[model samples]
Target chain A: MNTKAFEKLNYTLSLLSAANGDKHHGCIINSLHQVTASYPAKFTVTVNKDHETYQAIKASGSFSVTLLAADCPEGLIDCFGYRSGRVKDKFAEYAVKTDGMGNPYLMEHMVARISCKVVDSLDIGSYMLLVGEVTESEVLGDGPVLTLQEFTNRGKTTPPAATVYRTMAGNGFRCTVCGYIYEGESLPADYVCPICRAPASKFVKQD
Target chain B: MNTKAFEKLNYTLSLLSAANGDKHHGCIINSLHQVTASYPAKFTVTVNKDHETYQAIKASGSFSVTLLAADCPEGLIDCFGYRSGRVKDKFAEYAVKTDGMGNPYLMEHMVARISCKVVDSLDIGSYMLLVGEVTESEVLGDGPVLTLQEFTNRGKTTPPAATVYRTMAGNGFRCTVCGYIYEGESLPADYVCPICRAPASKFVKQD
Candidate 1:
């Protein structure tokens, strides 16, 4: 089998977000598809079982999908795709809004957002295919949907954006492994870096 | 919900083909997605239950996916998409080949073809989501993958291709509703137009 052929297939990129109680997480995925066009439409999103967002969906029983636009900033992709949500609050820096289902969705650089309730799920070993029945959907912008191929092409021509750390006032613990900052009076004894999964021992107090 | 927004999201066009014993059928779909990137890759295809191709896959336990290329002729799409395979043999004019799993796949204007064995299926009202494990795949061409949006755009500019009926010397039946031609010594009493679901009485003998 020529696995490289799979690379040639184009897929639109989407941000799959879910919230379990107050814990919210989101990740970039390219496997969202509308399965049926009937009234109360259905869609499916393929997510790795290891993702924090997947766990949130499994617990919350719902998810919000935001189709990324062609004009989406590179920093947004890097923030969601390259880092682990477990070590950092992925939505803290963005203007996040809850859908009708109370699932979080980003408000910027998105073509559309759909709220879905889990109707069924199939476990495909490492990945879980979640079938979502559309509860509410809205067109956010008129920009073209971003494809994975176009995102890669853009990365080749544009220089990587510099990582911007949030300005901290007094007490801030930064993970040495992934530079994920935790703001508080002091780091908890059982604290772990959500992005890198590093223990408190790997964190240093920001000067 | 603004349903018009759904039309803006892009999807790559694919031909999902399956064979049950000697019965073969194929249909155009846009919901094929690679679910996992594991060693034995997994993909999901959503098919309408009303499609003859879906019944073929349900009985065969396997299917072949041909990702259409940008250069694909419009006639091919109209034949496989606009017509039903139950009344007409959609593959009669095309060069078809069986994959390792005995599922039929088209040989022209395709970027890649993948044969997959059904591992699991989920029925969602009018649609069935079939999960397949990749058994065999090959990259057929380097042409760009065709998106549904591109196909619609092409249709707007290019005039519709003329319908060319197959020439027959012996007894042949033509469907009045959909112009489907069936070449046989005599039309069966129970024969129905596969394309339009018209009854045998609706067929007229060709001169």
Candidate 2:
């Protein structure tokens, strides 16, 4: 559907976490955005209905957002984003603080922390869009906050099975050493990164 | 509500425009954001119900998005934002060209041009949330695409009567010549911009 065109819209990457009683969950999300800009500022986040994070947010009616830094370590993303929060205590390994409702917001490799109370929500097919009125917020540090394009430029790819997302047409190898993803029909035996000049041996094929 | 805390959630600025037959409309919007990243990359935009631009998007079922440049002129914001689209033809005075859908996207002071077809919508109180599947997009230039924090740092102020946006706490003076707003209970007679170095003599009371 000429979906490659969709790559033009840019967004910041963040983690949305929530707690319900003793159960707490978080997930990676690129869809967090501001809706209203005045006092009681509003934000909307879209989540897959089946995720444990979604369950926590729906039950608690509140969530915490941590804005990731540009140099955010891979371990943090793997812990909070790639792994399921229901399986373990995601905050156990990290430095953190709790909000009034006891939801955890990261204090490491993060630029800001925000707490919000869900004021409205909508069901959209496989997902639920939660609109929250920010209850408390604080800037943790300076930025440029990491962006979706920068994530891709760093060679991080989203699995198509998970989202209705669109990337540059075709697929190929990613230079894992530098996060410079190379898209093509096939990988050359001796190819190297245009940016980092790394060798083909460092490239991994896109799944 | 200690809304000053809400300053932590920052956003990018862009222009959302659509064509309805021979009529066209565009408005300054900071709420456009990606909702998904794959296939038909999807985005959501929140629009005030009363704006002509919203009516045009609904009637046309499509819209053009222009990611504006960091150095976007004050005149452009005044024309598309401060003025009502129903009252005048905004593009008549701006440099622009038509996209594949025969829709006009700005050519000057833009980082990219994107065309989208509305896929879904929801009524959210005073605003409508439009979901758009991007149909075509192309980079227009290099960017540090403008961020909301930069907009305010450049001296732009949100009208308190508008959306639920948050800014620095307390009330103070603004340097009229530079658009640099100074916040506090009162203005100092010897104050000067840490940026432009404009003196307090140029500062005016905040409304």
Candidate 3:
């Protein structure tokens, strides 16, 4: 299989935490996830060690998975994406609430929410795969679910420091055309036959 | 680790998906996944061969994951959650596009789009784990990415037909709360529990 094509489909899902009533209110978590069961719904979201959501789920025992819609305002993603809950009041500006299970959620920005109980967790090196069972759910409104493409097209870019660190620390390389980080940087640079390799020139430092 | 709690969590999650998607889509999948840095930013999605997504992923070697926001509108989750793509165009009414690779994305619907190439697949009983690498990525806008609570509350009033199926199937003795099919179609009045030992009043019928 073409690895490049595979990477293209993986989504950088934004995980929302319920308003924790702390200085570090609602934070954004970028997780790599896959739905395990649609009926008796189950999903596995892998959270990296560096992300705050990982700690939240570990401490709280459960978290919510809200799917972002395409029409969602740019500021929502920006505020949650760029600002760290550690320093900024992530939920200070938004209307958020707690769910039946006590998990926090952004009431206005999401299309759906699933409140889950942590059933199992596995340690996969730098990340932890937390398997959750859906106990409750809600579908707020309807619009197109956001695609990674649309999210990238927006002028908002990851801070240079984070981008560069993610590029070098991870296997992805910076895209020359767009600043997308192709997670295949570990491959030999000389090998270039099947796909277009973003030369080192294309990369810019990520924040 | 409390296996029972995990089981409960898993059971509840399956129920939520059922309520949202319903059985019209067939069996649901359950599994955990993680994104790893080997090359191409590989991630894994576990699915059941008996489910619709599993079949689609196997047939197409690709599938799109729409992260539903906590505030998702009505009928949106049902649109993607309930219907089977094999029988219909999941994105017929919506605008969508394929990335540098062949993975299809909903144009501006998602927070980000990830086109994946199925590098390897693993089978675990009823589920198939699809592992792929992230080739292309685009961030559209930002917000508090969607969580599960938002989804559950999005369609809170919807009947729990799917939930019934989740519990019955995951545990023993056809747990009606989740809808596991019982062994004896016409259970005796004094029938005892096979899975959770719940009373007969809890069992409900999907058929």
Candidate 4:
């Protein structure tokens, strides 16, 4: 699975946060899915175990999803991207509020906010498939939501250290059902017994 | 689902490409996997129905995976990130070559290359899971590979319009065993037979 493959899928940059003090803290990530009809929208995300964001998600059963706007302030992107929430209280630096359902929403710029309750989780080699229900929802503004292309066109930068690691491992097949790593010959014909062996019907590529 | 949910799972990012004649198009994608024990490793990638890169992948039959260095050139990133293979030959801008198995590889700054043969494809809504057999593999450099964090940190931008669409449609889960949404809500112990009456054990998430 290569970044190019993931790139082909359209997605939005979002931040998932859990209630913290009078606000919420979380990590910025991307998604190309809509689970609205399915009360609890099942989703998959990659979190470095060492990051504060990952710790926050594990501790809190609830998280907030703020759909980033294409026109969001560069400072906002930097606040979330260039800096880590572990060392500094990022929420304190900006206007924040706990949503009606206790989730946090940045008062800065965004398109929508969805508060979710954790439903299930899948442990991949290093990441987790976090399944949650959309407990609360809010639409902020109109117009197209910010996209990966928009984020990149804005000249955003990738974290230096992470970039290197992604390059070394190379891209490969990802188990859509369990987020497992299948770095081998085209998934076994049966493709049903590698890990959970849910069956060939359950896998999706990271691309 | 939102990007916040997806970010919790830390995954790596890499480049995937398919060569045809003098033209080669690439895409930036993620991989939820670990390297294999075999020298000629194998892997798979998901190709979307809407991406220009998917066409190149189908036409070429084989693709190359390039691991971008931590401090890779932005120009290099944009060449693959912003441009569409549908309109131009992206490889024309870079030095490239076909490996022993015939997959394309960037001439400079890549950590390795893995050539795969398409084995099977599973359609899940708008995207297709491209299962490929690893026919050839090579390691080009020794360093940390890039994770999703590094790609995001480098401030890689995205196509806002396409991204938003992807958000409304990707990384969604549908139970493979039973084709249910798995929304955290418990099914009545006696609940049975709406789609398939396989019982609770059969329901799986669409990862």
Interface RMSD of each: 9.3, 3.6, 10.1, 9.6
Kindly list the per-residue Cα lDDT of model 2 for residues A38-148, writing each as its tens digit. 234677888867567788888888999888787888787766655555456777887677888778788778877778888888765556778887788877767667766
lDDT of 4 by residue, A1-207 (tens): 332332322245666666554545665666323322222343334454444555666777767777777788777766665455545566777778785556566845777777766665544333444555557666666544665545665575432112112222554565433334567546665776353345665554433
Candidate 1 lDDT at B89 equals 90
lDDT of 2 by residue, B31-98 (tens): 77766432346678888766678888888888888877888888987777655665578888977787
Q: Can you give the lDDT of residue B172 in candidate 4? A: 34
Write candidate 1's Cα lDDT for B86-156 as tens digits: 67798899888999878889878999988899999998765678898888888998888988778777653
Model 3 segments beyond 4 Å from truth? A1-3, A10-13, A18-34, A155-207, B1-40, B49-207
Best by lDDT: 1
The model with the greater lDDT, 2 or 3, is 2
Candidate 1 local Cα displacement, residue B124, angstroms: 0.6
C-alpha lDDT score of every prediction, in listed order: 0.76, 0.69, 0.46, 0.52
Q: Whose lDDT is higher: candidate 3's or candidate 4's?
A: 4
Could you tell which candidate, 1 or 3, scores higher by lDDT?
A: 1
Identify the superior model by TM-score, candidate 1 or candidate 4. 1
DockQ score for candidate 1: 0.24
lDDT of 4 at A121: 55
lDDT of 3 by residue, A1-207 (tens): 222222223233444563333423344443424343234455566554445555667777777767666577878876766555445566677776777767777757565666777777765545556667768776754654554534656755542112111334545554332234555635455533122233555443332
| Most accurate candidate by DockQ | 2
Span of 10 residues, lowest total lDDT, candidate 4 chain B: B159-168
Colliding residue pairs in candidate 1: A86-A194, A87-A193, A87-A194, A87-A195, B86-B194, B87-B193, B87-B194
